[model samples]
Target: MEKTDFDTLIERSKNIRTAYHQLELQHHGSKWTIEEDTLAFLTDAGLVGRNTMSQQGRWPKTETDAELKHKLGECVWWLTVIADRMNIDIKDAVEHFLTKTENLLEK
Candidate 1:
């Protein structure tokens, strides 16, 4: 198998979601706005945090390792998708994020 780079991941993720949303548009006659989709992903990110707590025994051991990894992957996937929707490359976003955080940390 060919090694998948970040660019491939971004393309594959975008293609999969485009197909999914096409189906949603066909049957539901609607798709969520970018803000709505971002909020939905934010909710999923929160679930990942909750799962972390559960695994740590802070609440309950409810999340398996695979499940936790899946949610975390989904969070990254959604972030890439949102960045594409906003016309930015995920690589650029990552660079911008690191630069901003480093500058903030130096303050």
Candidate 2:
């Protein structure tokens, strides 16, 4: 079966996260808990927000465009990882959210 881009993204994110977990086990003697993963996601999200503010001239101009873009991508990666950890299908969740929001907006 052909894989959609999102499917590829999900697989890749899971693979990379699993690899990182292994690395954590080696270096730290344990992998992160789901709560720690959530915290890490929030940390990345905060960086994304800071970069956005920098872009909008609302914060110190500390990050480059590339940095901002990378942070944005990292946020998506975190969301995918978090969803998978929670047994939620990220694609379906996003689809439902968009559909419901669109329907509401059209009303």
Candidate 3:
């Protein structure tokens, strides 16, 4: 069977993160702990919110649409990595969330 898109994303994200960990080990003496990674994800999530506000004209238009789009993608990549680090399967988690939400909304 062919791999799903989500499966491909998980694999690629893990590979990229592994490469970054190697660089961090060489330069910083250690890879970041999961807590540090979660903090980084939160930081990016904040940027996504700020850029979204800029796009919506709620804030000063300091960022371009391309920059906002890049941040949005980065947030997804961060979520995948964070989930993997926590021993959660991101694809399954998303599926469960969607299914549960849909069922709730159907009532």
Candidate 4:
């Protein structure tokens, strides 16, 4: 697979959100309410159930590593939507956070 840049990832995330909303409109006769879409995306991404870390004590588990990775991607999609809805630039937000953490650690 090819590596994607930040811009590409953001665009792809937005596209997925748009497609999901379109489907919702078709089936439910309305675009997704903000909360509904966020939760639905998270659930579809398999991040809804009990926390995986909490289940680490159990030797046997059903979900594969690949599934977890996909769920992580879904989380990115959710974050992208939230950022866009709030008119926040996620790239800048992330950079600011990283810089702040780095400065704090250096002190």
Poorest 10 consecutive residues by lDDT, candidate 2: 60-69
Weakest lDDT window of 10 consecutive positions for candidate 1: 59-68
User: How many clashes in each structure?
Assistant: 0, 0, 0, 0
**What lDDT does each candidate get?**
0.87, 0.92, 0.90, 0.75
TM-score of each: 0.84, 0.91, 0.91, 0.79
lDDT of 4 by residue, 41-85 (tens): 668665534336425544356655566666677777788787886
Tell me the spans in candidate 4 whose CA falls farther than 4 Å from its real position.
41-51, 54-59
In angstroms, give how far residue 102 of model 2 lies from its true place: 0.8
* Model 3 residue 92 distance off true place after TM-score fit, in angstroms: 1.1
Kindly give the stretch of ten consecutive residues in candidate 3 with the minimal lDDT sum.
1-10
Off by over 4 Å in 1: 1-3, 100-107
* lDDT per residue as tens, model 2, 1-107: 46559989999999999999999999999999899999999998898888888888999786568898988988899999999999999999999999999999999
Residue 15 of model 4: what lDDT? 90
TM-score of 1: 0.84
lDDT of 4 at 44: 61
lDDT (10s digit) by residue, model 1, range 1-107: 57889989999989977987898799889876789779979998998988888888886676467788999989988998898888988898799999999999999
Question: How many pairs of residues collide in model 2?
Answer: 0
State in Å the error of residue 61, model 1: 3.5
lDDT of 1 at 74: 93
